[model samples]
Target: MPFVIAVLLAADAVSLMAAGDRAFAARDFRAALFAYQDLTREDPGSASVWVRLGETYARMGHDLEAGESFSRALRLNGKNASAKEGLAASRERLAILSPPPKPVVDEAGARERYTAAVRMINERNYRDALNALDEALRKRPGYAVALVARGSARMGLLDYDAAAADYSAARGSDPSLASPLFGLAEAYRALGQPAKAAQLYRAYAESPATDVQPALKEYALRNAQSLGSQ
Candidate 1:
């Protein structure tokens, strides 16, 4: 009877997961949320389920709930990649939602904020660095240096999507900045989008303006080879 009960529970979980996937594919995040939430109730220890729930919450713009879900997933499996990504993204969104300090309004003030963020990054305090970068950007929306710095901080936290956005924005705001190419490639790699990463890495490797280091080029080339389209 115990064996039969175990089999029944496993089958139910599988059914729930299948339903959740279908809902997610259809872009009905609320349905996905319901299915994943039920799955967690039935199998509270499933780390992947918590990660899925976190992702769904993030998609629905509930940053607080998303963070909580990611936290649960991390508690279950400290090394869960999806949970780590979700947690970092959630943290950024929560910070963005908060009220910003009075605008610094001066280039020198923005530079000061950016320098403070750099110090935070050096200390490995990524979250505080993000806050500082956010303030810097608010003071100077087109500050390419601050954008790149913020992207670096996000990358350290494994928040690949946000990092990619920051890099892309920096590149757009200042076309002369070749540094964003390398940072953008790294973000794509972390997000498991190897094709985009490889393409950008190859561009950086081939560009004379950006190819300041041969070792970095070799490293990028090897990564592209390892993560081929096949």
Candidate 2:
């Protein structure tokens, strides 16, 4: 009777582990979360189970829970790369959600703000241009042109990292767009990453022709400098 009982428990454990793995493989994150949660409750010593739970929480956007799960997994297995990566990503998402407060504006105000940003950029007022762009983004998220303009303004201010992020955001909004790629190449050049700058410049050069010749020329000059510096 005791042997039968032990066999039944072992079978149940195997079933639970298989269910968790199946849910994770299907990318059914919520289901994976539930399955892993149950498995962890039954087998708290399983480091792989904790890591899988963390990944599911991360995929579901439960950053705090994900961080905790990853921390637990790391405690169980210090060399777990997926757990470490999930923890880092969750922390980053939490940081973004709780970024320092800035002045807010409405939708119409965002258009006005972007117009002001453009005017300021034209006048070489880099600081004010960025501030205006920030205001615009607060009201209308994912404004690609505003992001590109902000990147250009940041380049003028020599803030290469922020410029790169803005240009990247712009490109993400429109992958085939050349302007953001040019901006990214210029930013990479400023940051002294010549190889990456050259690659981006090549991408921009091969992009479809638009009224972007002037920007392309600017990128070409930076790419030349990057190559010469190498």
Residue 199 error for model 2, in Å? 1.1
- Measured by TM-score, how close is model 1 to the native structure? 0.50
Judge candidate 2 at residue 31 and give its lDDT.
Answer: 80
* Worst-scoring 10-residue span by lDDT in model 2: 209-218
lDDT of 2 by residue, 13-112 (tens): 7888888789889987778788889888877987888888888888888989999999998999999898898889999999999968764547788889
C-alpha lDDT (0 to 100) for residue 123 of candidate 2: 96
Residue 5 deviation, candidate 2, in Å? 51
TM-scores for the candidates? 0.50, 0.49
Clashing pairs in 2: none
- Give one digit per residue, the lDDT tens place, for model 1 in 86-176: 9999999889889987654678878999999999999999999999999898888789989999999999998989999999999899877
| Superposition error at 118 for model 1 (Å) | 1.7
State model 2's lDDT. 0.85
